[model samples]
Target chain A: MITKFRGLVVAGAVALALSQPVMAENVEVDPWEGFNRAMFNFNDGLDTYALKPVTKGYKAVMPDMAEEGVHNFFENLADIGTLINNLLQGKFENAGKDFARVSFNSTFGLAGFIDVASPMGIEKHEEDFGQTFGYWGASSGPYVVLPFFGPTTVRDGIGMYPDTLVDPVYHLDDTGARNALYLTRVIDTRAQLLASEKLISGDKYTFIRDAYLQKREFDIADGDVENYDESNF
Target chain B: MLNIIEGEMLMKKSLIALAVAGALTAPMVAQADATLYGSFRVALMSADDQDLDLRDESTRIGIKGDVDLGLEGTKGLFHWEGQLETTDSDAYDAGTGTFAARLAYLGATGDWGTALAGRQYHPHYLWVNIPTDIFNTATSDAGEWAQLGNNQHKRQDNTLAYLTPVMGGFQAALGLVIAGSGDDADDDVDGYNVAAKYSANGLYLAASYGDVDAIDRETWGVAATYDIDALKLVARYEEQENAGVEDEATEVGAIYNFGEGLSAKLRYSNLELNGNDGDQWAAEVEQKLGKGRVYVGYFDYDSDAEALAAKYVDRLAIGYRVDF
Candidate 1:
């Protein structure tokens, strides 16, 4: 089941790449505006009708501590991918600390149900193939909204393919169990974001697009962007 | 098991290693600099003709972050805060044992400074109350905000606020609120606040206007402050109007920093509430103590309002606050 989804992601990325030049020429970097807009609307509809309602119900029914533990458990699973990407990006020291963090937490923290890593002087560093690509000087190409995944650029979209291969979820053999875990992770992450939705203004599409691009840049540079100008804020 | 030893070892070694790593890390810019932050504050108060009591003085916690935009200097901003009632003697009445949204807003910033839509503090109230608000309890210029419709527009729901880029030494802000509580047309921009503030080389100046459409009242104020090394001086004047009635106020104060986290200040404020006049005088001292401040102060209030003609009062308070 995991292999099937991975193949689909790769094929979609390849198809998008094959039709790129002519489609993207007129626009600075986003030639797929029409398709992207449609996808954005689709994703928004899903969130409004399915994900949001489920998240609200989940929060209402579960205690904050329990919800937080679920989030931590999934984040611990993500640390493996982060460690791999850190090493790929030549951030050896960060990778080392993160490795220790995961080991310590998984063993004593009951598989990351509790975050014992942070207080142990180990900080979390979220790394992915997308960031690794950006570190190696890959251009972001154009913006694209995935069906259910939401926002991503061409490079990041491709990066997701590689990340899925390394994700523990992809290796889980039981289809139903794996999908349940995946769904829970998605809902948990979305639930955390639900509270911050009140601050949006103007068009949600433009606001999210701009924010996603900027956040990607910040993360890729590991928050060390030399060209940053603070006075703008 | 071996894991237990590893956990204990990591804990013991991390304390020193983390401290050294913390010391070595260079100071970074403010955006997304820290996570999981909150503050704890508790205070004790004794008022004239009232017993001493320990109180919760508006404790708050929040989650906030900013993301840079790849365009011409723009950043996405978000903040969601909650106020909690933690003490038996809560200063705010109707205390409930739960966290309630004190502020929730989302917006963006660029060369235009910042603009947000949602629930947030009014810029007018912020600027006009800057100097006076330094006192932990004084929220804004004059206490008793709801007096004759002179309420400070602290935080209003359904507000669209903007702050202009600081140029030279000037920054300006505006807030427009649509109550969203009533369907009446008068509800739009019913609680608007606007202000302009300037600061440079130890000098600060501000002027603001606030209107409560629902109550048909308007407030305007101007204030200035000058800091000369350890000594600071402030003066302000404000006016309120409702129907045909009017009230005016003036305040002057001085604060002296004794260095090494210690400071002392005194202020006197006088207000003419319609036909009644009243005055409040206060003195305070503060000391900083690691992510927190501890302070004690005294205030004496005398009024000529018919209901309180024989109820002159004095209050003494000691408090401590810490943020993580």
Candidate 2:
């Protein structure tokens, strides 16, 4: 069974590699618009009625320094994934920086609560299997709004499995601790994005969709976006 | 004996291989909200006046999923679990030795409520007995004995259940076991159970009542738990009356986490049946590994009745369990 599954994975990767070239121009591909909108509405309702209030309460009780520390700790753990993706994308320098960030922060930063790597001039890079797939010319198919998971492309949705494997919290032995960490990470992420809500203008859905697409493009292109329009936002 | 050992080893290896394969292939099939999970638990137990033996502790594999029905807010859900027999025992010798069905149910849920059909866990087991079922080994747990006394009030076949959506930390479930299905084919309605629970701020309280018509048994139970930091306290009381023979059980337990994947559990239970009394207690320490744990425990049971005394003996157990 293991061998058969590995063969399937290899075949799938090869098929993805040999598929149609990336559709660079068509970023707003929403073939499942109706389904996506419904899911988006469901997610929005959950966020508004449940998650947002809980996150607000979390933020109100947590000190700013503590919140930052928690955020940095999760970021430090995430660097392990960034390092793997960097290596997969053949960006050895960035992979080395990611390794350095994790090592330094985990040790000198007191388990990443302090983020000493940034002070030491180590750069932090955001990389995932989705970006690696895009780097290898895989097309980001139709935009999808997953329930509770929010927005993603088909390619990125598939990427989530590999990312989950690399997640440190996912490997935690204690179920309670792992779940608490997952909840804390979600609240921290939402708290960080609370300030960015002001930047959204026009239709909230459209704005979020366009911004996510643009951001994916920028990340896939390593921030060297071609024909980027500053006035779009 | 060698063949049995070899078979068990092969099964263990195959299970590990299957888990790895599933983990690898999960990404390609990540379309729906589905999970494939399993737990493999075994214990080496030494009982008074008996030889040490390796035993299976309710090892099970299951798949559960929720699918968006595309309705306004409803989703379809299904769960199926089956126990894998690992020990060399005659208790499961009948054609069901290899694997036995534990839970198989289908349901739909929305804002209004949830309804399910098929064989599933009894509310009496979940809400009432679970508070004190903390031991790693299933054999020595007080909850296990309580269920045994009540004709194994765990899962019932041909059950149709409805659950009310939680409101203000309170939820209620009603289940009806239909006759002319599976085991209870001769009766009109086999049984019915109702359970209610309230959980908030580290405190949980649950109550349940069940009636089995074929056996003419009526059972009721209440359970409560409180959690503070690394410590949890649990207690439960249950009573059953069958053919004018009344049985009562009370259990209390505590769990304390020492951090760093180490924890301690202590539990005590007393059961009074047919004017006879039995007492059981256990203490265990567990060390958690990745998705697994290794534990050692001491259990003692004493009873005034000879039948009960012969069944529930003092034992020391060392166990390992892993879930995926």
Candidate 3:
């Protein structure tokens, strides 16, 4: 099943990459200047040669409805983690909102293959352990680039350990099945960036670094930014 | 996507029927506003006796509504919740349905504070127990009994409570739980509970006192939590005198967030009841899933009782939880 799917994903990715215009936005921050720039080049090569193509093929092969469902499923799962952070930061009301979303989408939305809650006026929120630390007044420190994983930070890197302990994918004992699911999640996420990738302009590393820090701030603040411009996106 | 199209078609065909139903029900529905809320959970587990056990985790449904009293800065609030018995061994064996009460109360809040009177939870239960109540099925509700007994508030019938507005990161509550009101009963008010709490800078402290008139018992406890980095530490101590026997319990728990939706918990408690002593150790790992929250846990109980003393390793549980 996967072998045939791969062929289509490669074809789709090539087509999509060709269609996207090369635009770069001037980005300034590089905490570990040399290390970060080198890592950025490495990640870009991996994305260009491998990840991007696979995600493109994935999008091409799956029906819009199926694609929507896959996206919704991961998002619903993410909310469970968000709910925990909400409680940790003592945002009880927001936690309640996420509880409602998971309940509605998981049941009525068919295991979160559909987002039944959003139409009901409930906004979806996202959070990570890094943001949780940030909420508790811990600074992001300095931005860093991971080898296989893309953008991250010193604080976020430390935050990764706890999230790893609780990750459901790791709980799955079946290695083949677990690895496959992890790959799917990664591809789905990368596929999403395909569209937004066109929005980059100037130095790609600086653009992503600044965007990452700003986005982290916004998430920590629970989306309470004022006069937010596209740079934060 | 499909549901919307289907709903639109259905609405178009049922426009006339809806017009009639809406006209008849609109007034009654508009008169009162209430939100339907509940957390529905069910789990399949190995039963206490090592049998395959399928059980419900306090699965409940409730409704809460508010009324504007026209008085400035004052409003009336009421809420009621009931448990749904799912896969109850009794129900499965007997084929019957049971609806048990969880919480039902009427309260009003103003500048002064909030006053609630009804079948409510004693303040002691809320202030001291919530920290350890993390699991979907085998939380402190079922597991704490091995060590803490019934000292925490699950709820009480014929009770009243008052909560002070928070000031300077501090709040206080006082409540009473009635055993019964009858001609022969010596003390209709079976228990009185009081609690106070302060929260600041990721640090929280709470203390509660309970007087059980029916049993002539007095219980007092203090609980605290501090968060640093990705770890949170919790400690609790309670001393109670029951039937002229002094019993004390101390619990220490640590929760570490591995990251957003995943975390682990370790809780250890030692209790001395009368001349007998007991201890409980529990560890659990929880993760967020698309459908709900799933958890795996291990519990150990060591007590002076014959049954527990013979075999210390008690139970292992896995469960899922979600509420709407």
Candidate 1 per-residue lDDT, tens place, B242-265, comes to: 766888877788877755565666
Native contacts retained by candidate 3: 0.00
For residue B235, give model 3's deviation from the true position in Å. 1.6
**Candidate 2: where is the Cα deviation over 4 Å?**
A1-233, B1-28, B89-94, B140-143, B148-150, B180-188, B303-307
Kindly list the per-residue Cα lDDT of model 3 for residues B231-253, writing each as its tens digit.
89988888888778888888888
Best-matching candidate per lDDT: 2
Cα lDDT tens digits, model 2, B1-324, are: 999999999999999999999999988789777889999998877777889788888899999999988899899999989988777667477758555788899999999999999888888887877665777778633226645323557887888999999999999999888862234667767888899999999999999998887767889989999999988998889898877888888888898775556666778888777878878777776667779876767777765523564657777777779999
What TM-score fits each model?
0.50, 0.52, 0.52
The residue pairs found clashing in candidate 1 are A199-B106
In terms of lDDT, the poorest run of 10 residues in model 2 chain B is: B140-149
Indicate the DockQ of the complex predicted as candidate 2.
Answer: 0.01
Question: Weakest 10 consecutive residues, lDDT, candidate 1 chain A?
Answer: A21-30
Model 1 chain B poorest ten-residue lDDT run: B140-149
Q: Candidate 3: where is the Cα deviation over 4 Å?
A: A1-233, B1-31, B47-49, B89-97, B138-142, B146-152, B180-184, B303-313
Interface RMSD to the true structure, each candidate: 18.4, 17.2, 10.6
DockQ of each: 0.01, 0.01, 0.03
